[model samples]
Target: MSAHYVGQIAPNYVHSTMQANSDDDSFTFTVGKLDAGMAILIGDKASLIEFPSLLLPSGVSSGSVVNIRVMRNDQQERRQKDEFDQLQEDILHTFGQQPPKAPALRLRNVTQTSVTLEWDRLSLATATLLSLDIYRNGERLAPIPNPLHNTSTKLSGLDLNAEYTFHLVLKTTAGTLTSPLIKTRTHTISDTSGISVCFGHVAEPELLEASKQALTNMKAKWSDRIQIDTTHYVCTDPRNPGAQEGSQGAGYAKAMQLSIPAVLPHWIFACHDQKKMVGISPFYLDQDPPNASSIKRSVEEVLGKQAPASSATEADTSGSPPPPVEKEPSSATTTQDAPLKSTPFAADDVPPSNKESVGVEEVSSSAPPPPIITTSAPSEDGDAEPQSTPAPPQVVITSSESSDRIAAAAEGESTTEDAVEQTQTTEGAEEDADGEMDEVSLGGPNGDDEQEEERRSY
Candidate 1:
């Protein structure tokens, strides 16, 4: 006999009859089919009992007349009903109780098409947790093994520039418990390149590009010069302080200062996350990220060894050089020097040779600076003598006024002792009694030495 659920009958259930044919009162019986159901339903969806297989033990021969005993398992049914009612009550109690929350939800590698999301798991009891269901924008998505199992997933093919919210639900017989809401935005189809940057010698292009594409999903440009338009310098290796005398970046630090930010590759991603260009002093090659500094040695390192730095300055109306200094007349012994080869220089133009152009400049009455004496290098020809010019005419003065004039001329007009220029029209003048001075020297012929000595005594 098998139990059958009969909703309309007086008993409300039935002992199902077997379809069989009996030959005699105590003879052969061939039982064919028996209908039964509703023995046990685990979680209400799956059937746990199969009546066909429960007719007899597995080794019993079929179609044999056997004495059948029918009995009602009322006590087992009552016990099963009590258990199910208790389970329903427990589910309600747990549902009313506060649901355990998942650990922090973190996002990474946000691109135009996708993003990576990860979160920590809550250590809920096995009985309390049935399955974990992921939800995006309130829509239920895939289910995981359980809530206690922390996991990660790659969300792909999302709308560009659109924001999305995600969460997880702890599903159980009691009810569903939702995790904390995590808000995020997908990458947009951006064409803006943001800022220009250059790479250091040690910065690996492939690694940086991979990292960049993973985070930004865009191509980055690499520059050679630290132009006024450039904003950052991506460096892989550490840079030294340029205060040292022989440091390669010393000139750039001290004079030619480049104002561009010198940073690592992560700075780009960080700025993108923050949605703007923040302080990058912390991301220097030699310094830590998100750091600040007063002495920007990294600037020198990025600009390389030069002066007048590569940055845009305040007074540069147009990033061009001011006019050259006006030449003054303070010297006749002017020396010529080779010009500077480097196009960009600060302070002053540096000549190609180590020797600098230093000479006396001749000037008029309102001379700004006193002339500096310049010595000529020795002549290459051994026999050639140095060219010498006569000094100004010497005048013997009898009056104090004439003496004052001479003194004034000595202080102001005398550019060089070798070059003595005098006013042609002067009333107060008595030429040196030595008459006309000869250009005679020791080695040269001095046949009139006696006369010259005699003329010296006025």
Candidate 2:
């Protein structure tokens, strides 16, 4: 049926007459019954023919007689075939004649240890892609992931100052196509072009600015924020502990965890001045500045040697002569003649008038203490009598000896002589405290005579 004659209708429905046909192709049929979508028809020869009920004339129910004709339109069929052939020719001229083109790869970036490559979108024409792979130095590295979608890839851990050859092999249903070989040389270790730095906690603003300027002069890339391609982290002075970690932000920490070197700002300046990359070991934030420990040690050694010399000089300047050394006291020295005072008596204990009268005798170490004398008041007969009594035991201690003894005693490490002296001293102290002192009489021998004399004098 002509498309112009076909009107909007249900897909499962059909019209009664399909086309105008000659009577030569026409036939009469009597419908016996309608079963499902098929109609049983009885032909003139009594043969049974199954016809589609949908193609039968409309309103012709079961048991109805109808004439049906079928014919092929040679003109319509010929026209459709010509149209299909023309469409095939157009496709062949536009796309089918060409095969899949090889990938055109080029270098996006080059570094001391890595390279990044990019290419145009793939053109497969009508061929089915089998695999796309990358090759380096005549060895196949690996197939590209998502070959039809991805257009770039990075190759890393390459040797510095080394030459490399790279190409792409695209495998498809039609044939294999390989890109042109690209020759490249990796940057040397001293090349500053490979440096990509991120700034961390920079304690000195001036230093940070200087470092940034240096990076620019060296043709290196830098950022304030860390990224995947960041090769170094520049921060505060390396001598400071904060430069290693605490003062840094999340980016700095991430860079460290990623194995990126954290260096001082001086490193950038150094590289700029030298026009080449230098060793980062001496510039690492966690490391002490080179030669610092050695310098400190040298200073300490000088100071150590100077201290004793200065002390000796001061000693020599003082005018007082050193105390004379005394021989060790013998066991029999100064036998306990009387109870000795455990501690020295205060000078204030003696009355001002008696101070001159009291004498301190410095005896030999083996000599006993002299007896004390008390003078009697003048008698009416014009005679003064003197009375003698035992005085408290006194020790003649030298300055150096006393100091050593006191120090040793304080430390509970006194020598044997000190122990014996200490024992005697303690005993004497107890006796003085507990025992009564005797009275000395300066009056006349006869008590009655003395009283009578006093009465007469009055």
What RMSD, rounded to one decimal, does every model reach? 22.0, 30.2
Global local distance difference test of model 1? 0.43
For all predicted structures, in order, the TM-scores are 0.25, 0.38
Candidate 1 lDDT, 1-458, residue by residue in tens: 22233222222222222221243212112333333421221111221222343544344333322433233567778898999999988977665554555545666445554556677766453336678877889998777653455466666668867888888777665566677788887655453243555544334445455334423433434554554334466655433321223333531232226555566665655554344444566677666665224123323322333233433353365744444233232222222331211122212211111121121111112243221111122333554322221112233222223345444433432323222122111111212332433332111245347434522331
Model 2 over residues 1-458: C-alpha lDDT tens digits?
11112122312211232322354445566788887699897766565667777776677777787766554566788898999999999899667798889999997667788877889999998899999999999999999999989998878899889999999999999999999888999998678887888887776555566667667766889987766567788876322323553444676668768788888666766566456878889988767645433333323323343343554576577844433222233233334442222222222222111222113212223343222222233434676533221222222222323354333323332224443455445434533553531122112346557634532332
Candidate 2 lDDT score at position 254: 80
User: Which residues of candidate 2, in runs, are more than 4 Å off?
Assistant: 1-98, 146-149, 199-205, 223-230, 233-259, 289-458
- Candidate 2 pairs with clashing backbones: none
Poorest lDDT segment (10 consecutive residues) of candidate 1: 352-361
